[model samples]
Target: MKKKYVRLISRAAVWSPRFGGLAFLILLFSILLQRFSVIDVTVFMILIIISACCVVVSLFFAVKALYSLWVYGALGGMKALRGIIYSLTTAIPLVLFWGFWFTLPALHDVSTDIQRPPTFFRTARPSDALPLKSVLIEQAALQMSQWPEMSGRRYDGSPDRIRESVLNVLAAYDWPVIAQKKFKGEEDELYIETVAKSFYLGFISDIVIRLIDEGDTTFVDMRSASRYLPRDFGANAAFIIDFMEALDTEIALLPLSQDEK
Candidate 1:
């Protein structure tokens, strides 16, 4: 009986790292597959669950291996140490993956213009709507506290010049504008709609940019809302900031007028 138990522990020790490594691979693949839309969301979700279970089982085996190593010492101890090292190394990525989310808010929708957010023509409605007054207030406060730099920007240029800069930046990034319209009435206003996709999970986020003529300057306001997840971990804000910075860079690169300079 003692020999049988020792053998069983030894076998588990050898397999723990393999199971943990397998779980890590499945998780990595699930993220990649989801990003490319190669697998159904439900299937990917199941993969995550299965991967978690595998990790748990691996952990159990690892503990058993440690116990066996302590009892048998020598060769058994060395084998168990190898399994522990492999399992710990394999679990690092998964640990970081979830650890990153712990810092972000649990809200899906994000907008630079919370006061008068640009309309979402093709995108889905925000998860926190008017009826959810408390939720909206909390989200607003959170964004204000976390990302005050996400607000609108004013460019010192003619409406046409600013519009050109915006279009140039958008095109340079290959954002694939879905709908864009410019109407000249009381004020020259341009509305543009685009989509942003995540690098890992291929998650979609709808973005809107509104440019309105303000006499000698043009005012730009943008809003970005995710299509699926309730929390984006500041991706939407990052997208808006990137576009604004790119637009500024593009505008600066343009030839300057003698009078303006």
Candidate 2:
């Protein structure tokens, strides 16, 4: 009778795909839980880190198994290939996010008016998680350098009209208004506070829009700050830009009043 032989790497390869599958499921569940508000950001982040580690471990075993098969004629080649495929598929999105973390400015808060950014009201659930004012100023400077078009807009309309347009745009974007108020002793100045969620991760962000009436013109300034991470990978700035562009289109689509025509 011939003696059976089983290589160590072959055994590892057999188990690698199982471990990779577990990691993939964990990553998916964590994201879904976070997105649906079933879990908090801190817990979600920890789970993501764990899943990422599992992916790395599985990949390591898969690579070792492949090396063993090539050098020592080990079995389990198909298993090793499956593990490698699973690990890479799970890693692509994480790798892209990590790339953004390094490439973009490290800012979670952004505003059209850096010197006097729109303030978040109590209803928006403001947090002290933000950095110091000085640090924010430095970060805002960097943001401005990168996104120079991120500045206040002046529209040839009354604050009331512009506020309507702003609200319409917000509704279109699905940002829920949490609070709104008129500036104290300044009836013409309107403040609207809203919350935005990232499309995929559902990460929450606080947004405030300030509309100041200057005769017939309204000056619009907006501020957006992430609730969880200190680095937003430009999400806040992108949010403001998209909103502004939408509002611009919305206002343009509005029919000219009898007086204007």
lDDT of 1 at 182: 79
For residues 1-261, write the lDDT of model 2, one tens digit per residue: 999986654877887798788788888899899889798788988888888888898898898888888989888788988887888877887788678878878778889887777776654354545543422565666886889988889998888889899989988898888888887555367899998888788887888899988887889998888888777877888899999999889988988866588
Local error of candidate 1 at 101, Å?
2.1
Candidate 2, residue 236: how far the Cα is off, in Å: 0.9
Candidate with maximal lDDT: 2
Error of 1 at 2 (Å): 19
Q: How do the residues 102-188 of candidate 1 rate in per-residue lDDT, one tens digit apiece?
A: 777776666667766777555444454221111244478888888887778888877677877777887887787888787778888
lDDT of 2 at 60: 86
C-alpha RMSD (angstroms) for model 2: 2.6
Best by TM-score: 2
The pairs that clash in candidate 2 are: none
lDDT of 1: 0.73
